[model samples]
Target: MVDQDIFDRLLQFRPSGAPVLSVYVGVDGGPSALRTKLESLVGEVLEQAEAEPSQALRRSLLSDVARVLDLAARGGPPEGSTVGIFACHRAGLYEEVVVPRRARDRAVVDATPYLRPLLAFLDESRRYCLVVLDRMQACLYELFMGELEGATIVVTPGKPGRPVGRDPSPAHRLFRETADVADEFIHATRAELLLVGGPEETVAAFLPFVPHHLRGRVAGTFAFDPRTMGPEQARCCAEAVVDRYERAEEASLVAEILDRVTTGGLGAAGIPWCLAAVNEEAVQFLLIDEEARASGSACDACGWLGLVGATCQRCGGPLRVTQDVIEEMGAAVIGASGRVEHVQAPTPLSQHSVAAFLRFDVPHSAAQVVG
Candidate 1:
């Protein structure tokens, strides 16, 4: 599912100039639900456009709304009893339209315009990952893993009929191929996570083949209705999975490093931290959660600091509490050349802590540490 906070933000968004139209198709009996869906859809579309009215997005939203309404009028609902809500720039333009034979087809046709804008945004955003899974039977399963503004890695399970099966005995063969493909992709892109989304069964069947080393980076599987899966859905699924994976990895790494530091075991820590302590050099990496980083709290204000101190023991300054102490400490370990890697925290962490990635010099003894 899309992040609820992000979804909520999309829902309340209002656009200036021409009004955007929103459509909702639900099986529920209440008209209120319909109204809510429509309103929310409109808000989301506008918000996705960053509250800016792009002519291309406006036209696409209008077209998608029309097509969805047409589908609703003709067939009532699709196989899943799916509730589709659409919003556009105008209700009249999309109202009373003719439904297409295939809802998925119509969706793709109308979604092209919207996908363009989304693609542009993805290409520009510095903090995001795009995962693309093409499940079309005739085509090979293609997985593209890449950061929004960084490197990208593409993996394919080879042509579909290559003796791969879901059977248990074939698990070894499947794992070998998958690992080979993943290794190649990882080596080429240097990405931290791999996101795979498609039919639930397909994703599940293929999961075991992913190498053990990459398991932590596999993230999670996402369900996509084949008939309704389009470029937009693919993009959304990729973003959701990548965002979650990156966040989880960063959090895990940061937490591990912090545990060592708080215990005076920095010597045993990973990359940036260990190198910093040994050389007494400025840490070269800093990772901070966007939300936590926004608070502008002093380093001594971190919640973990209480475990270490009540005030700025080093500077005798007041401390403000925050959930990002591990990140801050990691940052301090990796001084000058350090670079911050921001990631969205997983739902669990979002409730209890913040996460980030810090990079610094490699320690001379780095080979001894496992991270």
Candidate 2:
């Protein structure tokens, strides 16, 4: 029997679009005492409402609530006796929302009429969840909401340069780097189904490291052709591997965006030269890759040197190319500010290539390109 307050919290639970949500559920005196009280509360609620709840409904609700409370109770010291139920939901208003079962903090709230339909949708669709493993490396994994199916989970095996066993061989290094690369890919994309192929030994060594929660989601595995394999291959393979999962279309769209950035298309040189032609005020964000960032040089036409330098190295003329480039571009659009960011190239592709995320309403064109 859940406490009235706890039940009410669950019913009224609403989360903002913030990055995370924390929830707390209060339980009765002790575990044994709380369980006894829950039973009594359930009986009383049913009797007072004059509604005979089905066994399945009663059991499911009680079990989920109990799980939440138990998790909360695991906190040490100040929260030892008390339990909490915490869950993370997408940050948005949606018609239907499905809460995860393993959430630690839980609170009961009024069961709104709209909640039924939303819960139903979540149950049917089984929204996938993103799992980030390494913050620095940006390795990610995706998993179905419910059961783990036949999913190919990609992982990076072994430390950066350390050998896993007695022998140090080129094959071993390749194996380690490949696994590291795969892990990095997963961390970045957070894809649920990982498409991977390599030596049988490598596969065996890597599989054991996958988290237990993700074990059930393994879709299937295949012997990958390692000869032609590279970053592009991995991307394509990941797309193919997770085909059965939800949001495949969305994943493809993201892959396409990545592809554009990987090539020179998003590079400073690749972006239309005309982007510089737009009014300077319109520019908002100025994304620059580490490799693509260049110091101000003399204008081709005017031979004028720009900021950070004393004078036009080539011509004695007073240099004019400094902050004006950024200012000129930013003026074309609405009220806009400017920033410079550095990016890394996607692996197994052009090492020299980079990407910039320009924020402005104007379309990309040759005339808009600026220095």
TM-score of each: 0.37, 0.21
The TM-score leader among the candidates is: 1
The global C-alpha lDDT for each of the candidates, from Candidate 1 onward, is: 0.41, 0.35
Clash counts for the predictions, in order: 13, 67
What value does the lDDT take at residue 346 in candidate 2? Answer: 30
Task: Indicate the residue-level lDDT of 289 in model 2.
Answer: 28
Tens-digit lDDT string for candidate 1 (1-371): 12334323332332222434433333343444444444454455445545446676666555554454444345444232223233444333232221111112212112101121121122223322223333332111323322123333333444356665553344344445555666566656565556666567766766776677877766566776545676556656666665565566667766764564445443233332332332343344333333432122232222112223335533556655433334334333332334444434533333323322223334435323211
lDDT of 2 by residue, 28-51 (tens): 355565555444433433342234
